[model samples]
Target: MFFSPAQIYPFPGTSLAEDPEDIQKEVLENYAKDLPPIYLDVVQHADLSTLIWAPLMFRYPWNVVFGKLSKQNITVAGDAMHPMTPDLAQGGCSALEDAVILGRHIRTSFVQNGQVLVLKNLSEVLGKYVEEKRWHVTLLIMWSYISGWVQQGGSGRGMKFLRDAIFYKFLFLKMVKYVNYDCGKLDF
Candidate 1:
């Protein structure tokens, strides 16, 4: 379900080792007060005893996440390359963009070579894909982090004021603009 203003639920790494049921119980208890009535109703009515959780993890744009974009014939994309908080709702969409762009690069290489793609050729092709996507992915990671921080309410009154004024008034549109990117054609 969607919440108008996003919510932040922090799970420290140490807590992740707990049993699923225990974790679920703890999460419900922790967010009980913050959950809206509609969500609480769904939880109760649907008997949400289990949670299919994937850690919503983030890494800086210049970290190992960026370092591993392309290495020889191997290239990272989607969640592997740029995992972000769910605030911007762009995680899956950006991954799809990566797949389409990667496929196009591979297909272009095959067409130009007019022969089977060998290891060296594949590395070159993958490198092209990485070059095409690296800056775009960096923007995504940075903006998505900002979007999450502002929407979920930051640590203090200053942040809260920005969230209420600047973010809502102007920043939301700018953030949405990122998601409207044109990936062009796969042409494969």
Candidate 2:
């Protein structure tokens, strides 16, 4: 049986002194009572003692992420470019796509001359990568934030009902169709 994990977000932040086991116990207590056997089994088998904690933070005004995609010959990818909430689970997938797309552009542009390294062509090639990725990442950031907002329980009952009944089933599903994209093969 498939058991989708649920998280209650915007939780009070964890401190260095907080024990992972304690946190795990609290989390399980909150949900285990209502979960089915499969979920309880997962909780039982989980080694919460080894779990590492990190802040669940997202960058607001996503333009900041887009704005820094490319500068001179350097460009950011993955979490460096778009630090997003995990609601959509696209963060790592998008990063891997970025690498492939960037590699393709670099191979097609800079390596065409058979030169090992071409400093002059670097900027131009990286610019193309940024151009191709900027809008896509922007869309990802915005949608991820919206998805998180809805899942975390929106402003009120009306908003929650709209998100769950209408937005999630219709608009969000359509948006997700665009996420399963192919960056295509890098022929090099």
Candidate 3:
């Protein structure tokens, strides 16, 4: 899928009153015109009449104050707890980690409590799950945001230098190192 930034003007030519389809078409045409020949060729022949304009949404990790992710026995996982940019490609992977870690904690509690779901034990299990995942998810969110910013921060000289020189040459290794993280075996 082609991902392109679209500008939404608040005044003059385009307004909220304008038809959404017309705005999408105008934006696509305007942005697609600057594409390199190879990409332009594909866009020109492809059907864009049905193209959908959806806003890419992500919350900065700092926007959320670090606090308890569980209230009593109820808890959250995945995007519900931490929504991040797709640059790191860890959204789904981290969700799976949450599952494994949560399950591990729950399994331990279950086994210790003679396979019965005690409310107090479940609450402690959720707390352990949150404690285990909180910092990891926070780091993932921060790194993903930074990665996206550096990659798509435009063609300015400073940004290009940072993206190409600093990020690619130095920090890329650290960025991908999280992939080696073992969520551990879920077997009981």
Count of steric clashes across candidates, in order: 0, 0, 0
Window of ten residues with lowest summed lDDT in model 3: 1-10
Candidate 2: the clashing residue pairs are none
lDDT of 3 by residue, 29-79 (tens): 776778788887765555556554554465646533476689898998989
lDDT of 1 by residue, 43-139 (tens): 5554444555555565667853347667777778888777777777888998999889888988888877875666688888888888888888777
- The regions of model 3 sitting more than 4 angstroms off are 1-52, 63-65
TM-score of each model, paired residue for residue = 0.73, 0.75, 0.74
Candidate 2 ranges beyond 4 A from true positions? 1-8, 11-21, 31-54, 64-66, 154-156
Model 1 clashing-pair count:
0
* lDDT values, one for every candidate: 0.71, 0.72, 0.73
Per-residue CA lDDT of candidate 2, range 1-188, in tens? 11113322463342432687766676577658688889888876788677654656656635644366677788888887777778788889989999999989888875686846687888888888887887777777767866776666535788778787987788788778878878899885
Q: Rank the candidates by lDDT, best first.
A: 3, 2, 1
To one decimal, what is the Cα RMSD in angstroms of model 3 from the true structure?
A: 6.6
